[model samples]
Target: MTTTAAAVAPKPTGSRTAALSFAGTLRSEWIKLRSLRSTVWCYGIVIAITVLFGILIAQTASATFASGGSLTQEDQQSYALLVSTLGIGFSQLVAAVLGVLVISGEYGTGMIRSTFTAVPKRLPALFAKAIVFGVVTFVVGLVSIFATALITAPMLPKSGITPDFGDSQFLLALVGGALYLALIGILSLAIGTIVRNSAGGIAASLGLVLVLPPVLQIIVAMTQAEWAQNLAMFLPDQAGGRLYAYAAEASVTGGVIVLDSLQGGLVMLAWVAVMFVIASVLLKRRDV
Candidate 1:
């Protein structure tokens, strides 16, 4: 029989045909991040430093008050801000080291080969890792800051330092501190991805974040050069430091440049953006 047979087509299976989504990549990255013991230790150290330092500062201020030392309202606010944010200076280094370890560890262990293989278009993995790490870091930083504030709030009253929680500037300082930590971590991650070695990544990250600022300060002190001072203001640490600075007034005076929170944030974002671009390009071109 020469009957025409109906055309038949194979239906695609959902599992085989489904593409790897960014959300799926993010979830995978998050799984890897949370599974690491280093992540737990680093985050623990961050929280401990923040809370413990806040306690120490609050106690010191309380003792001062008990000994009859006094501060004006502005000074009190300054002290409160310091208590809440003092740990950020130290915590940032920890966060940076953690950031480096996150990527460099993968490379060190050769898991990056598998990582890239799973996601043939490698940039998505890089971005997924960055986004996952950055968001977690920001949340952790925020929690640590707010926890310190809450723990120290009662103690501050003993120092005649009552914090106005509703004040916009005070709230901004707290939020800014967290934001700075996130950016610093992401910047370190970009550095780590480019370097692709744990020790080298750490050294490079610290050189830029820790060593450069003080070196520039020393040069400024030696020469009192206006350009040197202005240049230092744009360095990552210096610019990021302004983000958490409370009630920093914009200087209209010549030879004095002060970055408000927004200015500092933009500058720090620029630093991260530039490094990330370089890292992305290298990651795409380099062999795993």
Candidate 2:
């Protein structure tokens, strides 16, 4: 048979050569995020935990009040709504889990190879995931807090816990809880990008948030070092917690978070910015 060679065509130009826009990457990321079954589970778990825990706690308190228990102060009871929203603490773990999975799961499944191929400019992908996941987590956190507060508010009266919806602390706590979780999502996503293993990312993120604070506390106690406690205050979780706090209580570790909300938020963002830069640089330099 006579041999013939087929010539390869030149690549298409203009739009075909155009890089993916940041907005397009964001929308694509959002679609991928929402499609995951874990996304649904994480949000559901957080919201359910908030509402159910609030109800159960409120009922227990009502029983105690009926049996003659009383709060130490009237104002203490007014914080009942904010108290019910303590579910955010647990919800943060779920957010961290999801955030890690957002990037690391792709790596585990080898989908990240495809992702990097699609956008050779890798940093935009990271930014898109962070923004989209952050928004999701923030909305989930906000809804969880507000739903718990609404559901528990009426029942709180039976428990001798009066909740003032108009209370400044209450409002700030709700908004702050959402903002806090959103930042957690971003921080964990950055960590996930850095670690590139779902379990490792999850563990590192949680260890940073949950494990580090108590470790600092122990160190503070053992060494009687004021700096140890002060250091704990600047931790991502600790600083994020301030967003929902009624007061900026002093920590014994070296991270002593200031009383100012703006300062605490800035501190949290500072951590996010550092990790974000690290993740971005690594993503650019490393293999998919």
Best by lDDT: 1
Local accuracy of candidate 2 as per-residue lDDT tens digits, 116-211:
877898988888899899988888888888878888777877666777777776677678878988898889999999999998999999999899
Per-model TM against the reference: 0.92, 0.86
Per-residue CA lDDT of model 1 for 211-279, tens digit only, reads 988988899899887777888888888889889888876663469587887898899999999999999
- TM-score of candidate 1 to 2 decimals: 0.92
TM-score of 2: 0.86
- Backbone clashes in candidate 2 total 14
Could you tell me how far off, in angstroms, the CA of residue 240 lies in candidate 2 after the best superposition?
Answer: 1.0
Question: What clash count goes with each model?
Answer: 0, 14
Most TM-score-accurate candidate: 1
